[model samples]
Target: MEELLRFGIVGCGSVAAFHAQAIENTSGAVLTACCSGNPQKARTFAAAHGARAFDTLEELLAGPVDAVCLCTPSGLHARQALEAMAAGKHVVVEKPMSLTLEDADRVLAAARQTGRKVCVISQLRFQPAVQAVRQALDAGAFGRLVCANLSMNYYRSEAYYQAGGWRGTWAMDGGGALMNQGIHGVDLLRWLMGPVTSIRASVLTRAHAIEVEDTAAALLEFENGAVGTLTGSTACHPGYPRRLEICGTEGSIVLVEDALVRWDLPIPCPVPVGEGANSGAADPNAIGAAGHTLQIANFVDAVRNGTPLLVDAQQGRQALEVVLGVYASGRTGRTWHPETP
Candidate 1:
């Protein structure tokens, strides 16, 4: 019989519900406990998920959880992950891993020192269309990729930011549109197009009255000599579907909200077009738990069978480097060179 992988969650916020649902949906995975800054919120969350609740992360770490899923504020991820790994538990962290490259390095260092697994949530990679495109790219079907472009135009209202004290701050939520909402696309761009060698960018807070940039744009240079553009905004009216275009010498592909809308290659795509309908463009809650479920299931398999993680801590850090590079360039008006990962 397969042993159950006991899981605990930190942060009972809105995103934590998705983690709980994912854990519940995954085989050989159980949500045994949870913790949050608000004890009542933790208790309520745990009760809804049939789990125990703790008032603090330290108490949760002392319990019977084999792994910890960190759904806390962006700034808290690396510190909490390090604490969990040090306590002899594996970690599944939310996206961007950490706000800065230095903190991300610390988390990776701790994971290496503790010999514990760390998976970062970049769940769109699990989409069938995305997998097919990745396979095509890997097999040299794309033939010398030349250009990649990503558009992540999401919407978050003033009420959304005002509801959480930490939402728009640089210290907690990290950067606004790109780091908070567009990172999935950033990760996809990096994964599909390869390492980002350099970036030049501009950022501004145009919509909501927030501390971070609600709109951002960047020009990127990939390691393979591919030039790409990334534009992210929480101010786009009616919030259009996120789009990605990959162009190569042989063919080109287009994806809209995880769906492969265009396949210009000679061979047919393994998956049918427009299969995935999920999107978080206009509403964050609309993204659903399908991707989370797939990612958590993969994490369970890795923890049980010694399989490789789809998005490890190092890859998480690499993604963070791209976002941070944009921020640095925006602030300094210089071309930022990201370290090769």
Candidate 2:
């Protein structure tokens, strides 16, 4: 029998709970330890999850674990993943893999150097609707993508940022609405549209007092001659489901909260409809374990079977570059092209 891969959860914040539930539900993995800056919080979270608590990441690194699940702030992902990879542990990072493209590329380079498998948590890729689109794309149903648009016009209350010290800072949380909240859809847009050749964008802090923008908008030109727009805002009061619309020469589909609200494809392409984990469009921490569960399970299987990951470090970096390009375009007021590392 294959040994169950023991896991460690670093940064015992709210996002770690989804990982905790996922480890419990995963067949080839188990939660062995967890770490948090606050000893009391670490102990409490560990006690609740049947894992040993470590007060520091260094201490956790010295302990037994096959992989580390990084649930830290958005800005810390690259550094943490590199540290863990250097320490000989696989890593799984939450979205916006890093705040900057430089950081994302650095992490990717380190992962390659260490030969440590690193996966980013973009669980929407595993969602059924996304899966269907991927399949149809493979089948030539969506021939030559024409245009794509993604929006995350959801709400996040002031209390939401006030709940944690690291919530709305530029250093840790990175950008506000787009970087922190809407990145998943941003990634989905890039994934469906292919690599971007250029982008123009603007970001604002219209509604929040944070160091980052509460709203952002971008226009992108893909390598395939397709153009797209992205709108991400936390100022959308009462919160609506996040939406993604992909238009191709032959077909188009619209998704709201990972659900296919519209499906129009040429030919007999049937999109399989199924529920994924709650993506926490409104509540940042209200995510479910199913998507995380599937991603982590697939990661473990990749480890055990030497298979390719659905979202590896390169894919993660590409998504980060797309988001960062928007920021650059916003600052320069000129279209920016992503620099490949």
How many residue pairs clash per model? 0, 0
In terms of lDDT, the poorest run of 10 residues in model 1 is 268-277
Q: What is the lDDT of residue 159 in candidate 2?
A: 87
lDDT of 1 at 22: 95
Model 2 over residues 1-341: C-alpha lDDT tens digits? 88999899998988899999988999999999999878898999999999999989988988989999999888788898889988999999988788887788788889889988999999989977788887887787877888888888889998888887787798888878878888788878878778899999988888877888888998889898989989989988877778788888888888877677677888653665444346576777666777899899989998889889999988887787887888889988999986654
Candidate 2 clash pair list: none
Query: What is candidate 1's CA lDDT for residue 81?
Result: 93
How does each model score on TM-score? 0.98, 0.96
Off by over 4 Å in 2: 269-279
